[model samples]
Target: MMHNATYMGSVSSVSSSSIIIELAESMGSGIVIIEGKNYRIGQVGSFIKIPIGYNQLYGVTSESNESSTHDVEIIESRSRRWIRVELIGEMIGGEFDRGISEYPSIGDDAHIVVDRDLKQIFGQPTAGQFTIGKLSSSDGIDVSLDLDRLVTRHSAILGSTGSGKSTSTASIIRSIVTNNDDVRLPSARILLIDIHGEYESALGDIAKVFSVLPDSKNPLYIPYWCISPENLIDFLCGNISEAYKTLYLDKAIEEKKKAIKTNNIKDFPTESVTTSTPLPYRIKNIWHELYYDDTVTWKEKEHINAAYAKDGEGDAENLIPPKFLPPATSSNPPFKGGNNLVKRQLEQMKSRLLDSQYSFLLKPGPWTPDKDGKIEKDLDQLLADWLGHDQPITILDLSGMPSSRLSLLLGSILDILFESSIWGKNLKTGMRNRPLLVVLEEAHRYLSKKEDGLAKQMVQRIAKEGRKFGIGAMVVSQRPSEIDETILSQCGTIIALRINNATDRGIVKSAMSEGLAGIIDSLPVLRTGEAIIVGESAKLPTRCRISLLPPNKYPNSRDPAVTASWTQDRTPENYEALVSAWRNQEITKEEK
Candidate 1:
């Protein structure tokens, strides 16, 4: 029993954590069977066990080379040559752990790791474990990840398009909150940033969907005042003078103070109030005042008589600019009032205000402030509508959003949640008490290194301090190379699916442990849905197939079958609905 059929080779050389094993010439079969199960020899990522006393050190086969050319199969040919192994972990007193307690000397016998050995290494399922999928080599065994480390340390899921990346993402989260085996985790909070609005049907049964173009009762509203005034000012007013900027912010603060007093918000920390505070202030009213101040004309030097058109004072609610009289050519009566001409900047701001595409931000329902900065409902209800729902997940669908503002809106959403967590750290409703997992789909769009958007800034903050605050980010993208290195490195666990692009594969390679180059090398040929999981969350580097979601549960990102569709009977050519959908930036039932 000491040297059973599992024995394969002997260590010929040792250098630190790396070792070279010389295959035994007696075993040229290239296959070993244990309990009627076949195990291939000299396969990369396969485990090799070395024993010294009661402790057993394990190493994974990383590379294999033959001494002479042969015509036989690659697996058979490599069985007669030496193989390189990277030291992974050890088993002592029936317990499996990472890192070796003792190094195996040269000439130590190394045996193939079998089913029982894998069980010792992976261990039985436990409360701290979350099963993502099963081991590829061994179907009966599961590959469970360390849930606490996976979340607290942050994680990334990367792969090329059509590699089952989105499906894998949906499946992974589904595993967490799925109620099975008498287990119930109703408090599991996962906030998915569905950039393309693809997750509504994927996780609808288990997730609450909030869309900018709400098809249901839950209308997604992000009041402009909820974001920092400094950021919002830039988007609202193109480029205002520093003096005008100050005046605008002052007006905002005044309105906020008035709101605090009028609403009678008790025990408020007024001293900490700044232009950055998330407080309600009517945007239309602010824009109206600024426009009038910049362009108003006075009939006299004392400004006793105002120059107004026959239309009276313009409606601020409708963004009607108060018609003003032109400045007098003779420098009398209507003069260019002492105010500076901010026509260019204010004009830009007015165009933004008038665009219907930005209604979610400009005229947020319920949270929108009246002319007096009084709101129909406060921020508390907005938070509850997003986080305090019956489902374990909340999907914010931003498919209807314009790409130009994607970064700003996404970043503002993150800022809101992260700030909430920071302020309510000790409270039961805070992120610390009930941790939140924020899943960012198509992360490269906003997190790219070349862009300096608000999304990048807020993501950097969350990546650095979120662990301590019980907030986790899962960045999902096809192009990992485009993501900022700082942000990518912060992710302790990386689930790399099949990557065909060399640059993308290289980026994924660099993000993983340097010792697993052999495993990373196998990326290009991996089957769709297969992934290599490594880093702090994984006790051992694992290559396994991600559990597949049901067809109905798949994300709405599937490519249309061109061949199958073309072969079908042609329907009446009616592009009216298509044009209308494109013009409206929406998917009508007919178009869908």
Candidate 2:
């Protein structure tokens, strides 16, 4: 071993996975000069080496404190500093591997690890690995993640606002798509759920973006019938009586079966049609039938006055029918009590149908059902445009959607993709052959534990069972505390950026391995675009500064210059345009 005079400390306590280091009394200052190179003593999150025979054990300093164990009566005695380190891995026979085979004994010399030792531990980037950035301690050494484990086991990227979370996410994705040659993962399929419509401009060159309103070249559509019955009812009707729900389900099933038979859809099993079945049916027809049942009043056959009046009134426009409105006189005939139980639901449906904001779902081009309950397009065509595309990345932009229904819409999208993957797993073009990675941006919005909505449930299911079916999820969020704990715990890897909130940091800490819990305390002080990665994907817990990208390739999440804007002259045209966009519930004229 190369000898130097930069020794800082010696191991005072030994454990299977950690060791406590007592600083040398001769080291007066925390800084040391070795071979004309200056190195800091004990910095948390930094690496330390313990050499025993031909094997060298590596650890990261997690905690450090000044000690006063000696008697206070000795005024001339100086206080010593001690560091607590968590053993990460070991290097044996000049080969670095994760996990220690031998533990260091007390009195072992602990020295700071330099670039050469880091290079050996990190190893060279090979197939199935992509470099994210350089190590924070040593810029020369790069940090690479295992792509196979990253997708199959699942991962998460979390940080507070303005901490460069979006840029880090974009950089990671860009690396995956651009470094395919080095990683040997050319056919990577990634679906990004863009909540703010920011990634399109950043990754537009390599990604195919689909939005509520797309340009002429790219058609965007999400068929309403594609939504499961439970989600559909939740969106259209806030609340309804049990009897009304049963009636709705029966009508929906009847309509779906009829449409299947009429269209001769061999792919769908007509006899097994259920409320949750994906067969296309006319929503308008269901509404019309329900309206007829809710408002109509029955009359006795012996009531000749009512029968003659009905015939005479049919020819006159002024006469009102009992089917169209509630009866004015209750004593006129023995009739069923007013069955206006679905009045609120019908009203809600009418409002949703008329809202142009929902045109993408309700009036999807070619996917819309006609009066005869026939559609020009099918789910297969939609899936081809989304997953079976030439591009490796597909961005589903949901910025124009209403916030109130965003969770439901997201749930529908996940359901469609997951359900398709399950049924088509054995096929040549199924997800088993082409595994998918779904990146959910702002995941906390829909995955909070407070509500048991469809989005949360579907995401949870994907986290649990998706790996077996060739599906993976990358949950990106700023508020980790608010996200579902079950989903967070399921992630095998977590890329944590600078999180300042104590609650958020605590949540991340709990999800991470106990050995790495001490490193999480440095989260609040991490630089922008720098993160500490832990779990299956990373060989060892590492702090890395994400490589920078060009301005054009950066995500469009830069904060607006308030001071600069205020210095400029105000314009009426700008305000007018903003008002127009707001009133139209759209970002551009194409959406309107």
Candidate 3:
């Protein structure tokens, strides 16, 4: 057993969840060697123990300071060093559990926690635990997380740029998906929304990669008809008056009804259909009908609607006469008015149709309708392609997509998943039976509080109620301050890397427990790949150095070597290929 010589201080004050200790003069400001073992004294985020009879209480040192009493005799004056520690847990009968049944009284002895006590506090690796990293103070002690709370209760990973955020994310995902004898979580399903396509190369062998370019065998496509009416309008029409919106909705419903009748799909009731219904309809046909209403003219005398303006003799109006004949004049005029309300909408629709960048949504193979207003494929095929794959991880690579359409695209994808999970809750393949973890990278771009886009709404919904339905979200971002407070608060566990900005640190600190203020203050100085984990999934609030992955397993997020690139000779052939890629809107020629 450890002796009283190892004791460094006595508790000066006690609270419900914290204790303040005044250090002894002999153990001030540096490492204290006890029994030839070097033990660091009174550091922020380090642990200390207080023994009260048979039970021992563990706490993390949150703040440390040295102060002197104001005395006139300066030669005889002395300073006292003290540390403020937040109580983490208590150990009884050699087993550690979070929460304290009894608080240590003032003047109780405080000792530095050693390796044996740390092993007991962290507990042994079991079936439900996965290693995240090693303890910061003791490099040899591994830190593990409970997988159950990590997935079902939700989590977040936040850091600054170049702080190993992506690498840590990849490590956590790899640990969960990799088949191991000790960890029993082998059948997990994870969906990763890769905003920059940095993860495909890192996890491709173990995951199924999907992209808009269709360069891979398994291409990704989100049919236009699968999106909600609100998002569709946001994509196709920038903005419109309420009157025009009503007109558009009526036409959309008419088109959807025509498609249902043509395809002979009776699963849905015809009378209950709305504009937001997920059904295939001919987009071209709707445009044609709207254009005709906007531009078609009629003969004034006949008072009959005509596809084209005609002359008094019922002949097509001739602007010019045959060679050498007198030029035609407008004797009987065409109708002076037409429905021009949809002119701007028609122009926007035309532009989107001609742009190849939107082909993934508008020109999805077999999902697009033919001239006869019928589709060869349905929503089931699209869902199967996204979620029914044999691989445990599915990566949706959005690097090739247009930046302007990112908000709409993200919202539509999440809506599809949310709706599917709700409807298929009872099925064997549903989310309830086989839970899903949807990882959203660069979440701040779409999930900001200033915007109420569909992506934000769906993510907020999943964060609030997803646990009961077996749906969990893992939000990854570099800016925690920009993320929605409601969504961030819903996360039961937080893995924070080095955050340097004051505003960002303040936001993160506000979300954490009050006792951990000192740990929060240490965010700016954390080393790369080191993180402070707190909340439900962790045994306690811990500062750990995340294990470094092999070069091959690291994410593709390294900065380019500036000097090396500048020194290399430039080739005309390389420039030509680069221009070709720029013109084609693709990353490489092979994507074509």
- TM-score top scorer: 1
lDDT of 3 by residue, 190-273 (tens): 999999888976778778888887464666788888887656866786786677666667888888888888999888778878
Show where candidate 2 strays beyond 4 Å: 34-36, 66-78, 180-186, 214-219, 298-338, 570-574, 589-592
lDDT per residue for candidate 2 within 1-592, as digits (tens), equals 3545746678877765867788787565888766566677778888889898999988888777734323221222445668778998888898878888888887889887877777888989888788899998778888999988898899999999988999999999888878632423457799999999889878887888898853524656788888877668768777877777787788888988988976678876778998888888877666656665666554653432332223322211111223432354656654444467777787787677768788888778898877677878788889988988778889998888888888888888999999998999998778888899999999999999896787898999999999988899999999999999999999999999999999999999999867677799999999999999988989788999998876788887889999997999977644777787788776764323
Superposed model 3: Cα runs more than 4 Å off:
34-36, 66-78, 179-186, 300-304, 309-333, 569-574, 589-592
Ranking by lDDT: 1, 2, 3
- CA lDDT, candidate 1, residue 351: 92
What is the C-alpha lDDT profile of model 1 across 415-510, one tens digit per residue? 999999999899999999999999999999999989898999999999999998989999999999999999999999999998889998888889
Which scores greater on lDDT, model 2 or model 3?
A: 2
lDDT of each: 0.84, 0.81, 0.80
Better of 1 and 2 by TM-score: 1
Using TM-score as the yardstick, the better of models 1 and 3 is: 1
Give the per-residue Cα lDDT of candidate 2 at 190. Answer: 95
| Local lDDT at 56 for model 3 | 95
Give the Å shift of residue 559 in candidate 1.
Answer: 1.8
